[model samples]
Target: MSKFIIITGGVVSSLGKGISGASIGKLLQLNGLKVNMIKCDPYINVDPGTMSPYQHGEVFVTTDGAEADLDLGHYERFLDVNMTRANTNTAGSIYQTVIDKERRGEYLGATVQVIPHITNEIKRRFTAFENEVDVSIIEIGGTVGDIESLPFLEAARQLRLEKGPKNVICVHVTLVPYIAVAQELKTKPTQHSVNKLREVGIEPSMLICRTEKPLSLHLREKISLFCSVPTQAVIECADAKSIYHVPENFYKQKVDEQIIDLLGLTPKQKVDPKWFEFFDKAMTPSKSVKIAVAGKYSELQDAYKSISEALRHAGMNNDAKVEIVFVNTEKDNVEEKLKTADGILIPGGFGGRGVDGKIATIKYAREHKIPFLGICLGMQCTVIEAARNLCGLHDANSTEFDPTTKDPVVDLTPQQKNVVYKGGTMRLGNYTADLEEGSLARKLYGKDQIVERHRHRYEFNPAYVKQLRDTGLKVSGWHEGVLPEIVERTDHPYFIAVQFHPEFGSRPLRPHPLFDGLIKAGLKRKENK
Candidate 1:
């Protein structure tokens, strides 16, 4: 008897449908209701695991090791819920499941059609996690007219019929374009988008319109009239300075009220507007810090969206404005770039495209006494750079790039008996890391034991630990097992790197410890400067 809300988009894609769905879920949770989120992607890839950052942006890893769409990351950060592999599904996954069942003879020799077979698989994934929570917010990827997304839309439509209209609600997010030359907001696109959605079997219970300007009353009425929704249900999502302001903005638009009324739910707790006050206070800037991020994917901003957000969250926590300067380590003159920033960051990536540049940046940071933070591959590079430059290990290198090194600073797992290929099958997702007492990590976390999400194939070779530490690098944190997880420089002002991606778990309210610590170190550097 759980309620459901399926969110769809039209007129175009990337209209913040995922964020809108997440905001609704957050609002529902704030009203004392247990909510869960699911994502349905139209892509043929089994998952986003094997996709390149340039193609699909970053592949977000869940607590249960699912490499999901980046929208799931937004859902987890907003709702504070740990998503799993079961919560995400794609066209490829659905087809794969059907084919696997056919191969296993579970279909009973019947010829499968798209209607019952494909839609059934999609429906099964949707309802699989339904009973686990009081409400499930399902966001369908792609626009309404996308042929690849038709099966998902059909499945969701049938689910509404099976679950009864009272138990299901459809929320459609569309865009409202404003013409600067004419100086008027147009509603024809939204009307056409609604018409396209109605061409299918589903009618939107609420229309969330993305607009640059405030939605005037006439436009709202026109959209409601053509879209067959109430004027009040036409929620305008005007642009906000920070995405953290979305919940309060939606609340002001009476989005929660419309949802509650549509679902026939009575509130158990009154909605509080004070959370926005807290968020606003946190975002109020008292100072500024500039941090340079050196990485292979510096050309693409979406490649490091989560990391950028984490830095912003740290700034919010400290009531400061963080100015991130993207430094393409692949470019020449890397040292000149490092000299201008307060701190240095090396993010995670695969392959050896710009690794030499990263090593050069790490060398500059270490030699100039700049605060440095590295993650995953960055951590390994830092170790290799330290071994080569500081410890006088001339042949230091990562086994990932140089498999035949006599003194490999970073290497593959000695425990694994076979050569491992990359993609989805890395040491991905959440794992526990025990911090050494009196270390900077422990001080920042305020706890000795912590768990963070990881997405990397290479690990820090523990055999080089003693030698690296003897040369002034401190293995400040490690997994309780034999493998090394985190390493820090004991003598530097603030230099640490981990084999995990803390950016995945960071939120607007709760910033990751490493990012917060890095920003603090940056502020200190700025003060000294």
Candidate 2:
């Protein structure tokens, strides 16, 4: 039988519920339980695929091709597990499912309402992989009292009844802000937050209080009295120097012991201390490297969450601290900002917001022999840059930027030519590409074949492949019909670009080969300097 863990936030937003949930997931996985994670969002949109990066951060694509919330990335990296579309659920998806069932007369002519109809669909996401795993950690997005998450909360409340109290664990994460002037940590907000959740018919089994400083036993006791939890159940989660150390932090509090006790589980094995080792190595590095990331949405770090985390993973593998400098091509001086960069990266993005700046950055990196990496649109920019500058095709441009360009160096594929939808309509999920022997990509991945995630519409024009290759540009990796997946400059040191997003596959313990190689190249540049 599978047990369920419900995680919800209270008092405020951006309270790090995602990290808390991920830490718990890791603890259970380390304790020899087969663990899974699910994210329940309270938005009306089908997914975050169509939403702007500024609005919802980057959309995480599962191996199964489901575009999910960014928190799923945390779960995957923490547990070292690949999530699927089944691990995600949203209000829009739940309602849409119910409506579709009603339209098909599956409801048997009964008047549909939010109670069992919508809540049942929500619960379906919880029990999705029940038989496959020992436990599933379900995180409900939005605040406690928000109208958007009511149906999710209601469904979670009823899960206890259906699964029996022993099969379910309700964990509520709440804020415990400290007032410098008052010289005390406030517990009122947490108490009121618990009260609000209690009104929804779910009493949190544990309180993971987010605090800046360590919570004294007196403070924990106060929260326990007010929140109706045991003093030991009030887990004081102080801010950590790094998010990776969170699992270790909770392990010290015996959080895993409490969880297994509540759910009545036998230990599959002793909890591994590898997370502590991982945290130790991350905190102490032998050297450092600076990598410049050029993109339009550079202002918000969350916009490129996976890319940054992937860089950190690479940094850990190389025993070097990776300093990420975001060069916003839209407003910053492209050349001036990248003058001191050891490496330059052009991440994925849509529209023509900063094409000229990105082109300039690529030209500078190529001419200066700096290690450079381009992805998706970035790879297209490489084609455009090589076409115009190397091949002297001044009119070279992507159709996405110039619809009537004389030389369409980048354009839509045949299958996407007449596509109408914007959301979830791109060439997404996993695609395979065979690497050329002795090529940079082949050497880095240590294999001829590789699979990576993609989320873009425009593709490098195959017609321009010969022209660019003739100009010393290498087509290192290719998909079907000789379509390019990875490209590089033979003349430069460690310059590689790909049409796929390798960051999605990168992990902390085992970094993706491309990213790890990028950091290694950056380190070499630092040494040569």
By lDDT, the best candidate is 2
* Clash list (residue pairs), candidate 1: none
lDDT for each residue of candidate 1 in 1-529, tens digit (9 for 90 to 100): 7789999999888789889999999898888788999999999998989899898888888988889999888898889998899889999988999999999999899998898999998888888767687788999999999899999999989999999998899999999999999999999999998888888889999999999999989989988888899999999998888777898899888888788878887777987766688777866699999988888788888889888989988888888899999988777578887777998899999888789999999888888889899999889999999899888998889877888887887877754426465546788788898889898888888998899888887788888899999988878778886778888887889988889999998977788889999999999999999
lDDT of 1: 0.87
Weakest lDDT window of 10 consecutive positions for candidate 1: 414-423
The best candidate by TM-score is: 2
Question: Candidate 2, overall lDDT?
Answer: 0.91
Model 1 CA lDDT for position 324: 93
Worst 10 residues of 2 by lDDT: 474-483
Candidate 2 residue-wise lDDT, 283-344, digit = tens:
98989999999999889989899999999999999899989999998899998989888898
